[model samples]
Target: MSFLDKAKDFIDKHDEQVDQALEKVGAEVDKRTGHKYTTHIDKGVDEAQKRTGEGDTRP
Candidate 1:
């Protein structure tokens, strides 16, 4: 499998941890760039995922 595919599989098997890790990553990016767009995009994706009940799929 490609690296991204393996990473996605690893994430699906450990979703909560992966979600938290994603949050932390977005936060760190926000910190480094002094831009909130990434955070906003992340939040929008989360909201869309919740609405669609497609937890692991992209929004």
Candidate 2:
């Protein structure tokens, strides 16, 4: 299978973990950047979660 297909399958199986990891990474980036890029990081995280078919846990 192509890399994209394999990635999709992996993400489908680990969506929850992926979401958590994304959140952690986003938070780290926000902290390291002094929250200057928090808005952009959040937007990217949201887009990534959507693309990965991961459910949004944000209220």
Per residue, candidate 1 scores C-alpha lDDT tens digits across 1-59 of 99988866776676666555566776677777777587585785476444332264433
The sequence of per-residue lDDT tens digits that candidate 2 reaches over residues 3-56 is: 999988998888888888899999999999999998899999988887775566
C-alpha lDDT (0 to 100) for residue 23 of candidate 1: 60
Best by TM-score: 2
> Which residue segments of model 1 deviate by more than 4 Å?
1-6, 36-59
Against the correct fold, how does model 1 do in TM-score?
A: 0.51
Q: Return the clash pairs for model 2, or none.
A: none
Per-model tally of clashing residue pairs: 0, 0
Error of 2 at 38 (Å): 1.1
lDDT of every predicted structure (CA atoms): 0.62, 0.86
CA error at residue 32 for candidate 1, angstroms = 0.9
Reference-based TM-score, model 2: 0.81
How close is every model to the real structure, measured as TM-score?
Answer: 0.51, 0.81
